[model samples]
Target: MWPADIEATARAIIADFTARGLKVATAESCTGGLIAAALTEIAGSSSVVDRGFVTYSNEAKIEMLGVEAATLAAHGAVSRETAAEMAKGALARSGADLAIAVTGIAGPSGGSAEKPVGLVHLAAAGRRGKFVHREMRYGDIGRDAVRLATVRTALGLLGEISQEP
Candidate 1:
């Protein structure tokens, strides 16, 4: 089952974007299609959400979102560079005014010494070339928590983009 607050936040984001005449898209990795699912749970989300890309694998990220293989090799799939490229590619591939990308290691076993579990990289890109990225180290918050947090943050980013000039 989905988080309870996610639906509320998704509705708010959809309302804000629809009011402002902005269309939104998502490029998701660790969270799979949860963000898209949350947004689509709202009744009028179709007016604001143009598309969603569930690029859960490096190959899928490369093929669907045009993420560079060099970038993936250099910084792995959970880096800011990859997230930015994912957001940019999503925006370019969709008819949305803004796009959000999420990539992370949300697991109980993928934790390394350097990049532990719950190290999420998020990015938001706009058609006007404006881009914003954030690196979140949520520690070993479990897979479910990490994915829920990522979805919440992604919706917040969409809300923030709606308020931008």
Candidate 2:
């Protein structure tokens, strides 16, 4: 995912959100703060980026994003349920108009028969009852690559959410 054009996508997303007068927040797991970093790379992103949470651990997700312990225990952090909850929690916690959450296994070790490495779950939640979720199989790209892909997907989700009616 590193080689992806993530910065360009993030810039476009920031421009769209700014144009729409929307504030954004991020809850990140496998990608850490890469999505936030990408957004802040733009000069005036402060107007749109409310905050970012790098909830790399289950406890942090529960504590910071209000992801329920039962959700994590039942579906694991990489599931769509966790991602959706994370997005909603970020929105509630930061008071942002829009939020994106990403959780994934970007690893050389975490791959299993069912949930393999590079399996990323992404979700976006907006104030207007807009919800978007996606599962991506990037196919064991390196950790940096997978994380970069996840960031790109997250930013793209923000862009799409801003366009929703």
Candidate 3:
């Protein structure tokens, strides 16, 4: 279940991608498969949604999305580097023309001086090297709020990437 704005955005993406004959894949970490779930929640989403990877753990990110261990080691799982790699990997592995990745620490815990609980990194990659990255600091919001905000931002990134020629 998604809010009205989120569901609307997902529907718009599905329709636009279908019209453009473009497909998308998702590689998710903290938001799990919510991006994919949002897209697939719409009717006829199968035409635009290729696959979804719920890579919640480091091993899953490495194994499923081909995220490098070194990148994870250097930048941690929630960094821009890992998010970009995840997006690129998803695009390479799937039939989709576009891919988006989301990694974050959404928690009442897991806060550090550098990486706080509401810190999120999102990346979108498209064919022909089209890419975009966004880092959001949503403050110490509740876990659900943080995750929902992430889904919204991730969808926006996908929309932005889709606009590229």
Candidate 4:
């Protein structure tokens, strides 16, 4: 039940990872499990997708992905630090060779002067200390649009890390 571009991206990732004999995992917050869901929606994704963590809360992020409480306290869950930690944690916890994490505020509400609605942070971690991060401010976009954009960005990150030499 995904859009054509997302489905195509997922299919491409599946093929790429399958060819490379690599697996991937996801740690998600505001986008829930949509990143993983997109990957798994492709046929034969089980060969590449190891697991997905739907860590939608601070507690869940700490427990499921081993995000540090102090990091959350200092930087909050939507920060780059938390997203990086979640990616690292997912890589550590799963059998995958690479992991992607996303944390964001996707809403018609929850806007503040600092972190407004549609603000998203994403990170990707790979074996051999490969890591990458991105922050996007979609700016008061509807929740669905923000979430979908985050999923697209996350999938792109996964593809990028997998292709790294």
Candidate 5:
């Protein structure tokens, strides 16, 4: 189940998407399938949610979403470039008019010299030639908190792109 505000946002997005005849897809990494799970938890979401790619690993990102090996190698998994490609790839692969991708280092342990825990990059693309991106540095929040925040951010990105003409 999703939290009250999260579920509310999902419902609103589904309603708006349904009204606008827009469908969405998700490509997720650190948040796993949480973004997809939130939307699908709502009733009548099937019409607006085309599919979700939970590309948690680099292989899955390449195989499922067509995230290039060079992108991953040069930028790592938790990066804006990877996030944008994931969104674009999902849009290309799915029937959706809009897609969102999330990549992040959400952890109690996966911090490094440059990429620290709770550093999430989000991106969304619309068939109407709209694109949006954001980077969140949530600090070393707990794994659950980081993941939850990512889900929220990802949904917000999707919502924003869906409104474009």
Candidate 6:
């Protein structure tokens, strides 16, 4: 039930993280924990994946990841700010060495003039205070495609961070 590219990325993340003796957590919105799912599909991911938070709603993001209501109101859930907050929260709350967060609109609907569908914001944070964020516009790529693309990018972020000394 996982894409090949995503599965490959996840396996690489698991390998890199395990080698580094680091753990990972995920805070997901649009991808709905698909990154976590991909990692867990690996045979030995338990040694690397700490947890996955499927914060699919604004309320869940607030309660689970400490995303502020004001932040959501000001920038909406799909913005980079919210994605950063979600990443920090996951890193803090899950006690993982690194965490990845994703938020987005992926759909045949939910498009606006400003924030259209297939707009995804991603963030990765490390406990040592390193952080990275990205804004991806997959552009009406369909929900499944957007979500899969998101998982790939998230895993890539995790891989990148894992390589850091």
CA-RMSD of model 1: 1.1
Question: Which pairs clash in the backbone of model 6?
Answer: none
Q: Put down candidate 5 lDDT per residue, 1-165, tens digits, no spaces.
A: 788989999999999988888899999999889999999999999999999999999999999999999999999988989999999999999999999999988989888979988899999998777999999999897999999998888888787777666
- Show how many residue pairs clash in every candidate, following the order shown: 0, 1, 0, 0, 0, 0
Give the lDDT of residue 54 in candidate 2: 95
Clashing pairs in 1: none
| lDDT tens per residue, model 3, 1-165 | 789999999999999989999999999999988899999999999999999999999999999989999999999998999999999999989999999999999999987999999999999999789999999999889999999999999999989988887
Cα misplacement distance, residue 61 of candidate 3 (Å): 0.8
Error of 2 at 112 (Å): 0.9
Least accurate 10 contiguous residues by lDDT in model 5: 156-165
Candidate 3: C-alpha lDDT:
0.94
Q: Model 4 clash tally?
A: 0
How would you encode candidate 4's per-residue C-alpha lDDT over 1-165 as one tens digit per residue?
999999999999999889989999999999889998999899899999999999998999999999999999999999999999999999999999999999999998887899999999999999879999999999887999999999999999988887777
lDDT of 6 by residue, 74-158 (tens): 9999999999999999987986999999999988888797999999999999988888899999999889889888988888888
Kindly state the number of residue pairs that clash in model 5.
Answer: 0
Model 1: residues with Cα > 4 Å off, grouped in runs: none
lDDT of the candidates, in the order given? 0.90, 0.89, 0.94, 0.94, 0.91, 0.90
lDDT computed for candidate 5: 0.91
As a whole number from 0 to 100, the lDDT of residue 47 in candidate 3 is 96
Estimate candidate 2's RMSD in Å: 1.7
User: Which segments of model 4 are wrong by more than 4 Å?
Assistant: none
Per-candidate TM-score against the hidden true structure: 0.96, 0.95, 0.98, 0.98, 0.97, 0.96
Q: Which portions of model 5 show Cα errors greater than 4 Å?
A: none
Off by over 4 Å in 3: none
